[model samples]
Target: MKYVQLFFIFLVTAITLRAQTIPYLQRQGTATQLIVEGKPFLMRGGELGNSSASSLAYMEPIWPKLEAMHLNTVLAPVYWDLIEPEEGKFDFSLVDGLLKDARAHDMKLVLLWFGTWKNSMSCYAPLWVKRDLKRFPRAKSAEGVSQEILTPFDDRNRDADVRAFQQLMRHLKEQDGQDHTVVMVQVENEIGMLPSARDHCAAATKAYRQPVPAELMRYLTQHKKELIPELQQHWQANGGKTSGTWEEVFGKSLATDELFMAWHYARYVEAVTAAGKAEYPLPMYLNAALPREGKQPGEYPSAGPLPHLLDVWRAGTPSIDFLSPDFYNPRFQYWNDLYTRSGNPLFIPEIRFETGDEAKAFYAVGHYDALGFSPFSIESTDHPAEEPLGKSYDVLDQLAPQILAKQGSDQLDGVLLDKDALEQQITMGGYVFTVKHDFTLGWSPGAQEEQWPLAGGLILQTGPDDFIVAGTGLVVTFAPVKGNDLIGIGRIDEGEYIDGKWTPGRNLNGDQSHQGRHLRIPVGDFGIQHLTLYRYR
Candidate 1:
């Protein structure tokens, strides 16, 4: 009897723990958080270059490099061709290898499913699917040329992807579901239409001529006021028709063609994502290849959840948690603003790996309340520990707890600064703060260079008069939000968080705070400091 009771207790505890550990998203205040093991998680993350995770032996040395960078999460690829080399038989060796290695390094993962499409091509599709063209047709250009991309309009193509993705998700559930090692899944890689805005295949043509789906038309009618400006203008220009073919409703143009393609692509992804969620639900998303400046539809990748198409994607793929951007362009703020609108939580899956990513990470998490930030080609650096990003990550890792606690409130914000945009004014905790790039001091040797290094940091107000500032190349000053009362720096302490506890170091009062004129973290320095402000007449 005693043995049976003990066994039953163990079984019950295991079941309860499993139920609690499945990763999910929850809204806290104005922000959304990725909750892992029942607590909010911030991904100090990086994405491996394409093909890095294909071979375990190739990834062996990369694990320590990631650890050195203090990345708690990794975004790696799971190739459809590799997993389903033969028609039916599946090999999970690569997926298993990634899970094993990621576990060994004590890191979580966001697996990118390179199925059906990658960067607008069917490059990662299984050879069997590619060769059996009759069984699996290709998307055609306007001139009737069969391109390498698979047509999403085809049931066969979508079903093939659906099966492969289903198997992968089911395997994850059986293997790592309880462990929750894989926190999220990116359904496809930079999915888009190219060479033409929309597919010109016979099936696509038929669909395009037919009246727009009532579901989409209904979505437009119901959310008319809430639609994005770009989309709103496009629809209104066509008299906001209640019923007609794609051209009749949205008009004849590249923009309309792109809109037509966006709907099909989104529905295709929705099918795959819905199937995977049915097997083992995980928070899934899609990433877009940002459009270049002044590029028209089809001149770029056309459409795959770009901001103007957000309404279409949301209308199509309710199962998808969000859509993200893979950055290789400037205007980080411009792109992020669009993605984060309409209650979508920002999570940067890829940015060009470069020097300024450290500062951007702070600005992203603090300013945008971003769930995470990642740089692509994370392992290319030779000196992993010495990398500036690694040092920034060290401070981020220490402040993760505090950052999470203060997120979703008015007390938290971030700033990104450079020569052109040197200063930003922030109002928090009944005080005004002037944050500027460290070079604004005009005394630094490199201040006069042609270009200034990117500088940024996050500020979190811990109390009415106290705050925590962390990042590189920033100087901050505080003043009264109202009246002419002078603000005085009561005290400042350079510190580090040891096991989530703040350990104060220097009494940065006289010179470090510049004789109470300002509180600064100079260029090339990455650390945290506590500051308290007082009012003086």
Candidate 2:
């Protein structure tokens, strides 16, 4: 009996240590990689529709579809109301079910905590918390009408959220810590204040009139040079005061209200995230509902982790690891550039699930070295094999090995082409390569349409004069950057990657490459081709 007890003790300790180990974002060369179980991991991920993960039945057919798309991770939600309906009492059936199913499907998970706020609404709060307006207050609009959003000013609100989140983390640690199946977790979804720039409730109104937190002021004063342009401009407009009320320090405007609310929001989230860390300490992040074009702070979901409010969020929630973009906007490149500013790693937790997203995914991973990209409403799509996204993911999976190796290095570059932009120029390895939209070949039916389809490629310079170029569409041409010598493609091996090793299928030449004039993947064909070039004197 004593031996049996000792054996059980040892087993429990082993599981605890395994669970404690977490995957982290680490830098290699100049590129950041998501390190899972002490090795680099690429997230070929997809997010479920809002209500899809709620039922085990709804997700039944979806699992195979995700696997068909070559996804490595599933971004599913964990609702606060469902998890803890009776306050202190918690229910983790849904979470456990997800873990079991995920393991069965051989996929990792990134659970999105739909707590307090989901897209800036208190839609996920429990009935008890939502019922008690006095204790669990809601944010208000300008005319004192209460909005469904919770006020960050209330301590009860923060404590309730923290308690619920802590319980969830504890449960995850107990259940999944040893398996390490869930690589990272999202603390909340598209967090923001809406209908107005700032919360107008009594508590929020009272706090707005007070001076900004000294910690925030100090952060602004300390990181003045590195502040995002919008935040910096707001501070500079009011003489960059050492300390004062929100308006007095940052001027009287909607931006000021946003700045004020952002601080409280960030602080509130920090408490919840810190509490969760105490239990499981999994990698946690927050996603921002981007500020829309032509929309003011109040017009869009203001605050959250929007680019301009990074300073406030950084000061408010130092516990939060990183910020990610929910990319619904058309300007993918511009938004990606903005999020990665200030050395923050780029990870797309959600984007529009349009077919064009496949191109954006290739460009993001290749150009920006993004940690991961997940399309929203992934299960909504039918027939993964017929979809362009599936084909894109399949190719991406093949090239991931080389892509991860070249991350943070100048040898890696990519370009996106659509109807508006048909071509781009890149210089790498002492040569200038011209990448164009495949439609330029004018051979395919879509090529002659009024608008060209999306096409892109990831270019990796593996050797001094050799490159592994993979993607659909576009013709690539090479030239010596500093000489009159003509460039020639000595050999082009069209092949597939299996287990990080290139297996050549066909020697592409003649018509496939415009008679060896350049390298072409052609329109309507998705492939990878290895090219070795030589410059003639």
Candidate 3:
């Protein structure tokens, strides 16, 4: 009797713990407030390849590598063809294997659903869908050539995708739902029609010639500034009315035509997402392939969730939690700015997984207050520990708690220092600081002639008089803006991280500590440090 009672108690406790864990999802605002375990959670994720999770043999060696990078979430894909090889035959084996491995590794999963679109192409549709031209139709070019796009107008295509997604969601809810191993689901992989902006098929053209939907016109009128550049230009050129036909309201341009097709595509996908969410309401997000400047639709990968199309998408589709950016371009600041402009929460699902841009990760977390940031192909690196990207993530993992608490507020700030430009000014905790390059401060000019060191730092205000400064190759100074009594540097605390803990490496004293209320570290490398200051004459 006693053994049975103990076992029952243990089971209840595990069930309660699992119930408390909230799946982290996107929230609206400059500040990211993801609720996980019923509290605010921040994501530190790494994206795997499209089909990397299909083979257990290929995934075995990569689990430990992911853990070493301090990743809390892994972004893996569920291929449509693999899941439904034949018509009406759905397989859950690949998904089950992925869930099992993720649970074994003690990690959360973000499942990418590779359905109608993958990288602006319909390459991931099942063999039956691909082979059958009558049951599931394809889009056509302006020249009437057939393209490999699954038509949104096709009921069979919609039904198949919805059925497959619903099954996946229901199975996850039955198996891992209790444990909550799967945190979120991506509805489709960059859903867009390419090689042509708007499908020129009879069905698509008939629908395109119809009047603009009332909801989209209202959305454009209400949020005019938030419209995409191309859409905005078309609307303004045609007098910007909210009550006209599609061509009259949006103008008869290729941009408007693409928007029409994109609206239907987003609506179709939203229907599929709504069906899946009915079974299990975990957070669902969609990613966009950004458009290049001076590139027209189909010329550059045009349609997937760029800013102008967002209003149309949002008005037409309500099932999606957020639209995220996949970062392969160098304009990190510009893209992030656009995604967050409409109070949409920022969550970078994919970024270039290079070693040098580790500092940008800090800015994404500390500066933008992003819900989560993930780099693509996380398991591709051989030596993750020694690599700069790994090192940066290691530091972020250590500082996650503090970062979560004070991000988006003025209490925290970070810098990504480059060799070409070295000066930065930041205001935090009632002090304005001017940080200069090594050469600007009259440091040995030879330091510039030689390989310049890579350095970045994060500053956080712990209390009214207490602050922490952690990073490499930084010299900090403190001065009061208003009064003299509130302006003096007191001490410096430095430390290194070992086995998931901060061990004090060194403490600067005397001249190194105070020179007219300024604290400076002449030489430092990859580590963390804390500085304590007092207001005095």
- Show pairs that collide, candidate 2: 19-177, 30-408, 31-408, 196-298, 197-298, 438-474
Residue-wise C-alpha lDDT for candidate 2, range 1-537, written one tens digit per residue: 999999999999976766555777788876778888777888888999999888988788999999888898999999999999897999899999999999999999999999989999999999999999888998888877899988888999989999999999999888887787888989878888878888888778889888888899888889988899988887888898988888889889888888888898998999999999899887889999887689888788988898777778888888887888898778888988888888778899999898677788888888889888899998887688777777878998898878888889999988899878888999999999999888787777887789776888789999999998988787898888997999999999999988878899989887788789888877667788999999897
Model 3, 1-537: lDDT tens digits are: 999999999999988787646475534334757766665666778999766787988999999998888788899999889888987788888889888899899888889999887887789998888999998888888888888888887778889899989988888888876777788888887777767888887888888877787777778777777676756877788887777667877777778777888788877888899999998888898998887777788876556777767777787778888889988876677788888766677788888787545666766776678778789988888987666666667777777777777866788876655566575777877776555433334465535554555456677788877776655455666666566655665666677556646677666756555454444543234456666766656
Instruction: Output the better candidate (2/3) by lDDT.
Output: 2
Best-first order by TM-score: 1, 2, 3
Worst 10 residues of 1 by lDDT: 14-23
Give me the displacement of residue 207 in model 2, in angstroms.
1.0
| Candidate 1 lDDT (Cα, 0 to 1) | 0.94
Task: Give the lDDT of residue 239 in candidate 2.
Answer: 94
Candidate 2, poorest ten consecutive residues by summed lDDT: 15-24
- Deviation from truth (RMSD, Å), model 1: 1.2
**Which is the leading candidate under TM-score?**
1
- Kindly indicate the candidate among 1 and 3 with the higher lDDT: 1
Residue 246 lDDT in model 1? Answer: 94
> Runs in model 2 with CA error above 4 Å?
1-20
Q: Is candidate 2 or candidate 3 better by TM-score?
A: 2
